[model samples]
Structure formats: C-alpha cells, structure tokens
Target: MWEYTDKVKEHFLNPRNVGVIEDADGVGEVGSLSCGDALTLYFKLDADGRITDAKFQTFGCASAIASSSALTEMMIGKTLEEAEKITNDDIASFLGELPKEKMHCSVMGQEALEKAIACYRGETVPKPEGNIICECFGITDRQIEATVRDHHLVTIDDVTGHLKAGGGCGKCHEDIQAIIDQVQGKPMPIRSEAAPLTNLQKIRLIEETLEREIKPALHQDGGGIELVDVDGNRVMVKLRGTCAGCKASQVTLKKTVEAKLRELVSKDLVVEEVRS
Candidate 1:
C-alpha cells in the first residue's frame, strides 16, 4: 500500500464540500469510471466574481477523493483568475504529498478546474487532440509526450505511475517508451519481433501483469488473485478473499484476467480458475 500523508487521510475520511451546487455558476468534470477515476466540481461565484462556494463528487481511489476535496477547499475563496493559477503540483503540495503512483489524481483535479473556468467564460474547451497511444486508458501520444517533458519522466513505469498511460495491458509500453526517448533526446531503439520467452521470463511477466494490471482492481473490491502455476500457455489461479465467492468472478476472469494476460503476456495464453 502507498503511504499517504496525514492530510490526505484526513481529507479522504472527512472530505469537505462533498455535494452538488445546483445553481452553480461554473462546473467542471473530468475522468471516467471505465478508466477507474472520475470527478465533478461545482462552484458558485459571488457578485464580484469571487468564488463563494465550491463542492465536488468524486469516484476513485483515496488519492483521487483527497485531491478533489483539497481542490475545492483551495478554490472556494479565490477569484477565478486566482483559481486558474492553481496547478497539479500545487494540489499535491497542499496535501503535503501524494504517492507518486497516484499523481494522476492531482492532474485530474487540475483539469477539472480548467474546465470549470472555461465553462464560466462561456468557452468550450476543445477535446484533446492526438493519436490514441494507450488504447486501454484512451491516453493520447501528445499527452504522453507532454507528461514526459513536464514531469521529467525517465521510464515507462514512471509514466504509468504518474499518468496511467502505460499501466494497462502493456501493449503501449513501446510507444510510450518511444515518446520518452524522443522527449529526452535519446536514440530510439530498434523494434523487432520479440524473441521467444523462456519459462522463467514468461512467469515473471505473468506476475508483473497481475501486480500492475490486475491486483489494484480486485483490491478495490476487497478481493485478490493468487498465481498457482504456469504450465505452458495455461495459467492456473485461485481467487481469494471476497473474490472467491463473487458471482461475477467468472466474468472477472474472462474479461479482465484473460484479456490482460493476452495483451501483456502471450497471445496464446489462457487463464483458468482452480479451486482452493
């Protein structure tokens, strides 16, 4: 588990402004549940165009909730001009610090604020334009490039932890690496057909896939997976905790587990459930 600052825990446990502002003067929304995080922000501006009220509804991890809560508190008394100046870094700073792996939560808060300000100005923020790079998360190549530059990200894991661009099925790893290489002025490595993996390499990748792509989702539901054995291309596993009895466990295995392994490990791989 990532260690969160005391303030992050405080705000998450007792978040302020957790509601809708029906007659809100400005509203901003960001993220999607399919991507595992979402937030909506509402604010009411007083006669002098100063923020008088701010609130938020968020669906995400503790970091996301804490970031949304902190964002509202930071903007409630500020003018639109002042609030617009708030950055993702500022949000992180206010909470003391977020786990590096959860920095995207802060980024989401910043984007919501930008959208809200645009709404108040009666201007439509154009959809982000770029070729899709991370198919699982819908992140774009331009976004990856920009994040690599802004955060000085040096590795695919850094990008994944910060922006979730390469956190999914792992097919985007090479593309994200290419973006990082370009941004940092490194010579791009040759891309060739991958050599056949040894048994150990395959097992290692499977464990990594479970950790990076599967565990967090199950953990959210009070469940977990245990890798039993890897025999050739068949992966035997057992669900533990709440997942053991979940009615949707089969669905989870098919849609999430198998799909993730196919994308990240070997396309020929099959996932099967084993009883305890």
Candidate 2:
C-alpha cells in the first residue's frame, strides 16, 4: 500500500470529477492499456479562454488516481497557459509529496495537461518514436534510454517503476534487462541458486526458448505456443486451439518445455500454462 498524504488519500477515496463532461470544449486522453494506466481529461473553457471547469477519469493504481484528482482540482479556474505550466513537481508538491517510486504518477498528470493544451490549440503532438523495447507497455527504446540517463537508473525494476515499462504483460522484460546490463557495463548476471534470474529475464528466456525450441515442437503437434508474460519467476505461456484440451499439454510444459528452457537459460524459470 502507498503511504499517501491525508489530502491524497482523501481525494482518492472521494475523488472529484470522476466522469466526462457532456459538452467539453476540449478533451485529451493519454497512457494506454499496455501501460496499465490511462487518463481522460475534459475541460470547459470560459468566454475569456480560461479553464472554467476541468474533470478527469483515470484507470490505474492509487497514486495515479490521486494525481489525476489533484490535477483537476488545481486546474479549474486557471487559464490554459497557467494549467500548461503546472509541472509534475508542482502536482507532487501540491499533494504534500508522493512516494519516490510513484513519482511517475505525477508525471502522467503533467503529460495529460500538455496533451489537453495541445488539443485546445489544435496542434498535433507527435507519436513517440524509437525501437519498440517494451511491447507490453508500448515503451520505446528512446524513452527508456532518456529516462535512465536523466534519473541515473541503475536497475531494470527502477526503469519499469519510473516509466511503467516492463511492468505489465512483461514481454519486454528481457530487452529491458539487456539494456540495464549494457548501461552498467556488466555481463548479464549469472543465475545461481543464491541470485536467481529476475522476472524480466525469465520472460525473455521463455520467449527465446519458444522461438528456438517449443514453437517447433507445438507446430509438430498441430499446435502452437504464444508467449504471454512473466510475473516474478513465473512464465505464463498460452496454448492455442488444439493444444488447449490436449492431455499432453501438462507433460510438454513440465518435462519438455520447462526443462529445456531451464537448461538453456536460467535454472530459476517456472513455466505455467495459460488458456488462450
């Protein structure tokens, strides 16, 4: 649970502006399903082009919900320019401070304000561009690099917590882990009984094994393997079509698929079957 301030907790528990306006002058939405946090902001402009009303709807954790609520409360009655200048720091400060790990929640509020301002101005904000690193969260390589450099992130978990990258379905956990390895100038950590592979590494290794071994075996069985994600050391793999009801599925996962992946990659990997 987050150690939220009284104000933050109050607003979260009894959030204001929880729904959309019927005739909003401008609206903006950001984050996404993949990111595990999404926000929709609605604004009503006055005759003087100031924000007479602001409202928000958010789908995320407690910090994210509180941040959106606070943002809406602060922006109402402010000019669009004034609202645009409200930074993440300002939002956090207004809330009496957020957890360092949840600082990204405040940043999301800032991003939503910028997008709403862009909509009011009829400007087209550019889509984030770079190699797609975290497919589960739609986080780009450039964003990850920039965040790591700016914050001096030293671990893959730090990067994910800050950017919400590898926090979801976790398909890109390995790619993120590789980035961490490269940045730190260390070889990927050797998985030992004392130091097990991280969740991200396990996910990556699972994908690698599926592509290299398990997929071919399933194809031979007139079935296929779809890599879902990794949560902790548990690797979730979905069995499709004919494989769903097959008796051999458990045998394949335990004896063949799990064994082979563990042998080739890390001994800590735990393969789990998921229904497609």
Candidate 3:
C-alpha cells in the first residue's frame, strides 16, 4: 500500500470533470487496463485558442483518478503552450506529493495531455520511436530512455515504478537494467561462470564483493552496508546511515548490491535488507 496525501484522497474520492466531452476539440488516450492504469483526456478551446473546458475518463487506482482530475483542472483557461509546460512533477506537486511507486499515475496524465495537444494540432501523437522492450507493458526503449532522462531514475525499480517496465514477466529485467546503465553512463555488469560453489566459498565471495565493490560505491552517497548472513543463495545485509531510511533502499539493494554480487559471486544470489 502507498500513502496518499489528503488532497489526493479528496480528488480521487470526488474527481472533478469526470466523463468526456462529446464534441471535444482535442482528445488523447494512453495506457491500458493490462498495465493497471489508463487515462482518456478531452479538451475544448475557445475562439482565442484558450482551453475552455477539460475533462477525463480514467481507469486505474485512486492515484490515477486523482492525477487525471488534477490535470483537467490545471488545463482550464491555459493556452496549449501553458498546458504543455505542465509536467508530471507539476501534477504531483498540485496534490502534495505522490508515493514513489505511484509516480506513473502523474506521468500517464502528462502523456495524455501531450497526446491531446497533438491531436488538436492535427499532428499524430508523438510517440518515442523504438523497439518494444517490455512486452508486458508495451514500453519501448525510447520511452524508457526518455523517462530515465526526465526523472533521473537510477534503478530498474525506479523505472518500473514510473513506466511499469520490468514489473511483469521478469524477462525484461535485464533489458531494463541495461537501459538504466546506459542512461546513467555506467558500464555493463560483468558476467561470469555459473558453476557450483561451496557454502564457505559463496560466503567468502559475497564478503569480498561487498568490501571491494559495493561498499565504496554506497559510501560515496553517505551510506554503508554490512553482511549479516548468507543462507543458501540469499544474502541478508543491513543498510546503514541515510541508505537505511531512504525510500530508494530497495533500488539500491537490488540494482547495486545484488547486481554486484551476481557479477562477481554467483548468478543465483539474492540480496535482502535486514531491516531492524
């Protein structure tokens, strides 16, 4: 479950401008039910090219509905340029703040607005032209790169939360990981042999990787890590300082810690935060 602000609750419970305009000047639709969220936006313009009315029909969770409602309210009386200037961050800010996992709702709203404006201009909705990477969500490489650049996303989980990539099937995890690495200017993870290892060997290799690789990287960000135990393929560790309480601890644990261990120790390795 995610924490929602009171404003978010209000908008979702009583979403303004629900339903669509029968004769809208601009209409945009985005997302799909399979992906867990979708939004359809409509806007009408006045003689002077100002938005006179805006409405939405959303099929998603509470956050998605709130985002659509907030978007419509934000567009009233604004020119297309002004509406275009409104970003996902702007939508999030309008309703206080959204939980990290729910950021995609605001992003969906932003995409719908862009498509709607494009429709008004008699132009095709500008989609990022690239091969589809996340078949589960119909996300493309260009979409992933754009979101990573826009949000400064650093991990696969962050990308999943924002774009729903790597959230399903688990087959696209590696691909999403590669995209994150490329966008962040990091080298690819080195792959090694997947041979059998004794428990003692596994423990030793995990410790060596933590000290020689993971800790230094985390320390640079004012964080620390410690090995607690190694039970079979599961490596339980404790995050120290800022990293322990940070909302992005899951991302750090998976993308940084587990990834490093997998490259150097065993491909079957799984990292878990030993939360106190």
Best by lDDT: 1
> For each candidate, what is the lDDT?
0.89, 0.79, 0.88
- Candidate 3 colliding pairs: none
Candidate 3 residue lDDT tens string, 4-120: 999999999999999979999999999987787889999999999999999999999999999999999999999998999999999999999998888889999999999999999
Q: Output the TM-score of candidate 2.
A: 0.59
Estimate TM-scores for all models. Answer: 0.66, 0.59, 0.66
Clashing pairs in 2: none
* Tens-digit lDDT string for candidate 2 (1-276): 778899889878988878898798778898876567889989999999889888899999888999999999899989988888898878888889888778788879988888888887899667777998877667898888767644446677788767778877778888887776554453333345555656666567667566645665676667877778777667788887577779988988889878877776767678898874
Q: Candidate 3: where is the Cα deviation over 4 Å?
A: 186-276
Evaluate residue 2 in candidate 1 and report its C-alpha lDDT on the 0 to 100 scale.
82
Order the numbered candidates by TM-score, best leading: 3, 1, 2
Tens-digit lDDT track for model 1 on 1-276?
789999999999999999999999999999897899999999999999999999999999999999999999999889999999999989999999988899999999999999999999999888778999998888899888878766667789888877788888999999999998877764223323388788998899898677655875787688889899999999999998799979999999989999988877778899999996
Better of 1 and 2 by TM-score: 1
lDDT order of candidates, top first: 1, 3, 2
